[model samples]
Target chain A: MQSRVDATRCLSCRKGYASHAAGTCKECYEESNHKILDLETKVAFLQFSSSLDPSSSPCFSDVVLVASHDATDQTDLAPPVPIHAHKAVLANRSPVFRAMLENQMEEALSGTIKISDVSHDVLRAFVNYLYTAEACLDVKMARDLLEMAEKYQVEHLKAYCEKLIISKLNPGNPLNSFLSCVLASKHKAKNLLDAALSLIVDNMDKFVELEEYEELKKDHPQLVFEIYEAYHAKQVETAALKEKK
Target chain B: MQSRVDATRCLSCRKGYASHAAGTCKECYEESNHKILDLETKVAFLQFSSSLDPSSSPCFSDVVLVASHDATDQTDLAPPVPIHAHKAVLANRSPVFRAMLENQMEEALSGTIKISDVSHDVLRAFVNYLYTAEACLDVKMARDLLEMAEKYQVEHLKAYCEKLIISKLNPGNPLNSFLSCVLASKHKAKNLLDAALSLIVDNMDKFVELEEYEELKKDHPQLVFEIYEAYHAKQVETAALKEKK
Candidate 1:
């Protein structure tokens, strides 16, 4: 018991006095251990949470790191050729592209990353997307990262962007289009099905139509009906508004 | 010109005169003709709009008309059991399904036909959606009514219920799945995507490995990276609530 008391002193102080007292004693040791364990657990929980929740973790630290790293690379030094700038940009100068590059510089300095807020590279990619309606995304990239784009709410840049590539390119390079669709769909990429449909509908001519297709059509009238109805309704609303004027 | 005036006056009377001085006068005749043309234009606009925005139109009235007009002696009394309720009622008792049915009943009795509120059959279909997901939609019906759902902000339901049918179902049949992905993605129906993915993902054995499969197993993550990033981040900050004990 005396030996145990000797071991029970405050870790901060090497003194052995008042071993039974709460603050600097045996009781304190036991209490602090529990407190330390709780602190460690909470720290671990937060660390895990920060990694998962990028926005909450630290203000765009990862974005700054990745962007800075990419910028430092010699390969990214040259002005990226804007793939599909607006017609005005192509005809004159890519103001949007320039503005986007400036924004990237600001973001890099501030150490912030809103995926919706484009970098020069992303803007160039966006232009490329607008013109080509797709981009050659790294097929081998982890899906979780691609999913992150969706999580960050970067509209038109996440999985749907990938869907665009799959649908338009149909690269058929051992990439899974279906999984891409699922991820995009999950992430609220609105045009995913349209993109998929456009791709698959066109492809059905090349491939044999599935039996399930017929059944789905029979059961789901809202599919085509809504399209027809929307087209007509818009026409009617436009006309009504015009007449009211 | 005199006859034209008389014709204009007659039209203004029928169409609700804008001003008393122009009632049935020569100017009124010209105005009435313009009004008729405007009405025609408005109808044309509605037609186009309904086609573009399928969900808003709810073409149920048209479907009902066609089903009734084209009925055969052997036709069933229940309007083919409205495809939506048949599956759920056949499947099991579901509370969401019941709530949807109640909502539909309210819409029908209300008789307002607001773009957001739908009739009983559509509500039943929505309930079916809560159960089976977007997989078994009647393409035309789902597409036509989706706009209504979107307009009214039943966004989650719209994403899950109708768009699933649109993306999964064949668009070639009377029920085209044209609005499938576009609307669903817009409304952020991740489950719908998952449902469609299950139906659509090709040869999963080829792509997903055993370990990867285990990691990707969850329906939703504890710390979702996208929309809730900021919210989750806030969680990290308030984590260490100092307990007195």
Candidate 2:
């Protein structure tokens, strides 16, 4: 009878109810309910958002896959699942990015990305690229991305695209490559002015025309006059050499 | 006689002259001539440039001083003295930059920068700030310069100014305290884009706007959506609390 009583006490202790509770432990129940409530809140938001916005289904699928696949892959600012759930939360949410991504993928598959030919898919891929940035990318794709981003009023995407282009503008790329980059950054995306000009300096000789020179002056007035003087000196020297010859 | 010859040799060595020749050797003559030639070049350029473009006369003077100082100093591509001579050399060849500089400066000092009340001097200062390319600068001057650079077409200057602003966006400077350094970078300069956004994630709520959110969506769709969602969730929670109250 004493042994039976001791066993009963031990069972109650194991159950965490003998010391302070009659049967159910208050702390344990609270913790369990708290977890359930948290899960339910998240699930309800996801379901409500999904039902409200069908256009975000693709993004939602991506989010869901990300959430279920690996809990460790949460480097992005967004939660890894049901991507459209965010759209429901944010006001004036637009599906512009969806188009950007698709366009980028299409352009990648194709050879070049004509600025005029930009579409929704390209925009979506561009958005994805910005979200999940990479260290290395194709130069051609980078250029296309820049042109598209600049056109679409996507400031962040344009900046990213410019950076990639600047990096690829090694000494090996011809001087002509920087002309567009310089113009674009100078006018539309002011942030790339330094990097673009720094690259252009290597090919200063290529800017021959008064028109081209004037354009550079308009963009970077301080640099143009300086370049013109140097060019004139070189011209004079060449003329003298020709006369001697 | 031998001692006399030895003394002559020592004097020749001091003057960078070949000992084989008698008083005032060839090396000394050449060195002296080169120094004179350098001085002459600077003076001629200064005079010609000043007479041709009086507006940039100060720049010319600065260049002459830097060139005449020392070759070693010329090589130092940092703050000490403005390397205006290198710029002068380039300007001598390119007329466009000269015209642009003259026009920009004229516009700035004349107070004709804004469409309504914007001062052109601010714009000119901003362009000059970029042209000078100094790593550090005066705070008040920097803000003024940034505002002007943005006003004019000196986008690169604006970008650099934005970078400087972000770096110094501490709470101490009440006049220019940043609510969100990242948003400031994105809004102020073109190149800052997604890269700047990633750095100031914690402060996104304090500064990001509805228009900016939409803009970010197209370029950095992932960041835009994520930040928007997080921001909205917080708002929702706050609203819920109010309801409870």
Candidate 3:
């Protein structure tokens, strides 16, 4: 009887629970633990040490990327810093780079690929992510990287950025949500679009009064129409559910 | 009373249990599920698409690895097929490759690394593992790759191969265990050494009569002594436990 009573106690929390409060069977809990450990090991194996340090021996960098704006700044006496990287890594990570390099384009012939309208720091981070799929990102950095990732067709990095942006979206920050929606729609980020749209729809009274929303309506009226369409569909669904009840 | 009974049911197995049979509390189980999902996402993000296809556009391969035996066979009309790879990837994955390539060694200058005592298929798999961190291994393949992984100081691959080899280790096959012990000792694989030693110690009587054991005793007497020492220590520990009880 004592053993049976003990058996009802939760293995993880060590608290006694009735069947309704129980989380999992012993076998499933144990299996999940093993799966977590295995996944961690695999993640460790797959993660690469970022080849960002140029001074490190045997970097084997075959190409250099220079930010175009920085390069053309004639007033600056010091030359624009070039970010060194492997062509193979760039080609593997980005279809844009693959086509540019593989087709013997001007960038391929010159060995220096000039990226337009990007800062040197952002370019460095972008190249670093090519080698190591990691970036320390805040909202602005995520947005910056997302733009570059979208242009380069690095879907993994784009998805990562979108997730970060969506996490930061708040009901109180309708302007930010509106801007994120615009960015998501521009980049074909369906997940971010849906998240931002839902947030805006839930707080529509507050969202419509934002100055940014007025500007967005003038510039991207098609997007505003889509949002209205989504809002209407949600309303219809809620009314139908209420009727069913 | 019905609702209270329902609350104690296991969430995973969907069965009722007393307090002792519960695996985890609700909070821990939910957290574990979230952790598993996060880890799986991380693994997917970190995994690189292997750059192994030579004919693929923009492969950007700057170095080739040739199997030494295949290269020397003058009678064969077909030249030894070289494995295409990037020096950056090789350097990133292996300290040996880093040293060889970064120091402007002959192989670095020539862009052709001659790997001695490895077959073409094994060499190809090894390079693929460097890029993708994946390999399909049987016992024989695991042993072969383990040797290369040890030589190149690819700790991730070595650990992976050791894990596979250990999983395949069976007490019924004492000779296989003995050989694994020897290999582990030679390569300083502590985990494999411990597992193989435990298996051999547990079945010492059967292990002692094997012809491979006699050969191991003759050639590697120190390893045989270590195994005996472990067996004696285990026996002493077991006797002490019995005495205490």
Candidate 4:
């Protein structure tokens, strides 16, 4: 038995494993490797060059998007800069843009779309994503983009942002997780909400010790109740499993 | 050893492999599964809604392409129909289009580009491929698209067509393989050229018996010479290997 086990070799890592530690047969493993390669090739073929890059040449932009800032917001004194884009790209990426452009809306006739309450950088990134399906995201950028993606009904971008935020959720940081929970709920990001909820439920005692917990209980009592409900359900499930054992 | 081999169950198929037929350790298999999922998600995200689809709402097309027909070649009497598209998409996909549109060439200024010696269906497919890196390819369609892709410098589409053509290459059918070799050489499709050459070399005796071989020798003697050179090199390598044994 020991000799047979020793003779076994993992095709992936080229190492010996115990019989119980086997993952796949040779045929299945090779099939999976081929699947990965095919998928990677498809991804490379599908990825487009961004029209926003100046070096791409002849963007032939037919529409402009200006981030309309409030007069009272004294962030910058300069006039709002317009981002050049193609109506076709914008329409293809977002249903909101399609409606705005296709139905002879005021923005369509004017060839200038004034987007209210969004910063220049966020709007630029949003448009770039429509062109290339790519963005360099941080926490703030992800949150901002998530909101814009939700408003535009760009499901791909929204899911991308949700994945990023969910990956960043930490059970060790209760306050951050709580805030993410709030943001997810607001944006209707179900996956992000679930991840944040799981983190909070796992560390409920630490979460309640934070000063923000009292404020959250007072201000958004429904959200606090929901978290407690999830914790209760988890406890009940664990108790039932223990009883069965 | 028999009992231990039976104990080693594949995680994927849940079947036991002989000790030497083990593929991957549990950790590497799980990692590969995750990587495949990640790549699949990325491919989904990157794939855009093609502007050619009318149901996708507004296309906002800015340029038109008409497949020009030669008067001498009477395939169809219908006037050349125009395909609407975005200049930005065309330029982003093909450097040839970028140069033509960016340099304010005759086609760029006219808002209409005339493509000569291409069927309407082939031209439409080519334009659609620029927007969505996909095509339904048969032997004739693949050959036509490969020529266009090579002419327009669309490397992705070229590779796609080459892969399709190479997949259809058969050593059992020497005539088809010979034709594919000729086409690959004409288009400079390196992968297709290599695959077709390999098929032809493997069945050199069968290929020499074909009627097309005489015409090819008389017309493109250089290509025929290249095939003989490859066959000679392969024979030398085989002889050397046998001597070493």
Candidate 5:
């Protein structure tokens, strides 16, 4: 009989592992491979070549998204960006856009959908996500996009932005953490909300000392109450768990 | 220490096996599960709600597809079916459709893209596939769609059709098997070619006796040679493998 050394060869991993190592046998490997192939092909079939190119408009795009701030700006940052896109695509992704475009509204008739209170860069990224379902995210970009996503009711983009915001949350930036909690509450994001509440509860002493904490108490007094309520609930739950143990 | 039985639970399959049985040890299973979720979300993101309904033509559809034969038909079998769709959707899927629509040709100007030499049902299904990356396929439907897919240069659909055609290959239908080999060669479908060649080689005597064999030899002498050549090559390879063993 072959020893543990020979038994180490994993069909899936295609590497030698310990005899009790984490890997599938040939059957499971083959099954998963078939599944992966099917899914990859489906993804390929579903994917569209992004129709966001401005100079060469694909012509079929029925509507335009122009950044309100960029339209007024004379500086060479970026000109009044009239981002060409399909109303069908916008409508399909966001119910807000759908209601705006589908009911013979002014937006539909005018063919110029004005997105105010956002920079051209954020607006471009937002429109691109409507077609491609992808975005490059940083903390600031994620927060801006999360607000945009929440406004549009694009649950997918909101979730993607929330994930990025949650991943970036740390003790170094308690203000950002608190803001994330506010966004999580606004978007009703359970995962981000939990992470945010946990961060605030764990570092309660330093959390109140932050600059935004003072402003949040004044601007959003209800949020300050929520933080305490969440902290108390967690303490009670932990005490109950300790008693059972 | 856990016994072999206790250590046998598959995280994916959720069934216990012997310790030496086919499955991953937790880690690979979890990795694949995460991959599956990501892929499923991506697929969901890419999928479109077909904008094909006629009652409330949202007026966004730039072009339409009409069954050419149905338009010409005098009988009341069905009305001249004008399948409404978007030029962007058509172009996104097929280069042929893209070229015809994007070039401002007669079809583009007329806003009516006529699909000739296909039935109303087939044309409807084809347009539906352009919107949703899905189709209901039987053997006849698979063959018809494969031909359309090849014509349109939709590689994913062609591969899907080729897989279906190859899977249905059997000794009982030597002519169909031979035909699949011809399709495989024309389409450069390696998997279908090997499958078709094996079916022909495995039932060589019956293949020669079939009526289509005489027709194939008359119509395509080179294809007959290819079938024999493939059989000979497989025999040599099998002999070499046996010798190595």
Candidate 6:
């Protein structure tokens, strides 16, 4: 029970601190602690097993999703393994799956849905996210999942993949930036689109010399226009700020 | 920016507060915000729907839990409604369920698992907690669920119910306190048991005169001995403190 003039320990880390280093007062600290505890409990309640084994039936999956593209791989020609999952989980996470299942579509009756344009690994990762809402992303996996998320109307996955793409964004690697821009436009990922556009605009001189830029101009010319548009907008904004100064 | 000498407004609630009312430093505030966002995302990913519809198969429930006690309400001759649930979810939440289901027990073959003694409402709440880790609990429901959680060996749910029960404990209500003591002891809810026993000992004079105390003594004389033991122990401790003073 010291006076306000005396230094207090932080409620979070419990380290001694002056007023300037204060995180919160005792009242606020206790309130935030309770809120965090509540959130953690909710997370615990929501968590299901991450097991994807068909035999285990971790979430007791009623439907199985198979990657059709896996058939193209000559290494394992027998058949593509199916990913087991539940319709209710799919419906809760994605409206596309919900409608497909609820309507008793041909796929629902057959109990197997084939997903094309995705390898078995990517399909597995996508289905895993549907059940667990988690993914480990390399650049290619993130790109593929971002497109799939957009196609499936899974906004959470799309936003998550977009963040992953942005986190790996490198201005020095303009080819990566260029590819991200094309992917962003195709998926309508505003965050990724903005990030890639900014990188391309900032490194215009270096990026224009690359062969990928010429290919992008020939392939995705509309996406190139967006970069120019953002570049000019940024220039005008910077000039306006200078004039105000 | 104002100097440390001038009180800064809280970033959290955005209130004009003095230094004494500080919630957190700017660094900790931003960090906590990010932490909360991460936690919320995890919660979103973990959340499975709480639908008990058999046809809906919210988590693709393989087993149906029927409250056997509900059949004993002779006025309703019809069989009790079965609560649909996922074996994977039940197995993940309770080791008892996992062992039973995995070992190919009679209940596993039957597809309908009979849970005796609990009513339909309690069974539904119990299954709901398995999927969502949440229960709308009053004191009686909390006690019942706590016992059920203990029976199922679902420590998370048991701890959750114990916290709720303890949070709502009223020391003045000795009848509630006495019952909680017996209930807590039965379930081995150390926190609740300790709290209830402390309350009983503190209000010994008023509590002993209550008719419920006599009933508890007649029914569970062992519990009565525990009360006296705790009371004498607390008295000895108090006397020691007095001697030291």
Each candidate's lDDT (Cα)? 0.36, 0.40, 0.83, 0.83, 0.78, 0.79
Model 4, B15-92: lDDT tens digits are 766866778988889999998988776676655565564334336777888878733355456556678887877887
Give per-residue CA lDDT, model 3, range A1-245, as digits (tens). 12456446667666665444568877778988898988787776666574586555427777989888875555577677888887877877888998999899999989999999988888888887766677888999888899999999998899889989999999998888888988998888899999999999999988888867778889989888988998999999999999999
- Model 5 alpha-carbon drift over 4 Å, by segment: A1-25, A72-79, A209-212, B1-7, B15-23, B51-59, B71-79, B186-190
Between candidates 1 and 5, which one is better according to DockQ?
A: 5
In model 6, which residue pairs have backbone atoms overlapping below 3 Å? A23-B23, A23-B24, A24-B23, B61-B85, B61-B86
Docking class of 1: incorrect
- Write the residue-wise lDDT of candidate 3 on B98-208 in tens digits: 899889999999999999988887888898888777899898988989999999999989998999999999999888998898899999898999999999999999889
RMSD of each: 34.9, 33.5, 4.3, 3.4, 3.8, 4.3
Q: List the residue pairs that clash in candidate 5.
A: none
lDDT of 4: 0.83
> Candidates sorted by lDDT, descending order?
4, 3, 6, 5, 2, 1
RMSD of 1: 34.9
Better of 2 and 3 by DockQ: 3
lDDT at B46 for candidate 6? Answer: 62
Index of the highest-TM-score prediction: 4
> What's the true lDDT of residue B114 in model 2?
22
Q: Which is better, 4 or 5, measured by DockQ?
A: 4
Q: How well is each residue in B134-214 modelled by candidate 6, as lDDT tens digits? A: 679997888889988999999888988998988887877888888888899898999999988898899898788887777
Candidate 6 chain A has its poorest 10 consecutive residues by lDDT at A1-10
Please give the range of 10 consecutive residues that has the lowest summed lDDT in model 2 chain A. A85-94
Q: What does candidate 5's lDDT look like per residue over B1-245, in tens digits?
A: 13455444444454544545655544666678777887778677767764555545644677778878775555876677688888877888899988988898999999998877787777777777776777888878877777778788888888888888887888888988888878777767777888888889988888999977778999878889988997798889999999999
Deviation in angstroms for B151 in model 2?
Answer: 53
TM-score ranking, high to low = 4, 5, 3, 6, 2, 1
DockQ (model 4, Cα): 0.61
Better of 3 and 5 by TM-score: 5
Please list the residue runs of candidate 2 whose C-alpha ends up more than 4 Å from where it truly belongs after superposition. A1-116, A119-121, A130-136, A182-187, A206-245, B1-245
Assess chain B of each prediction and give its TM-score.
0.23, 0.32, 0.87, 0.87, 0.84, 0.87
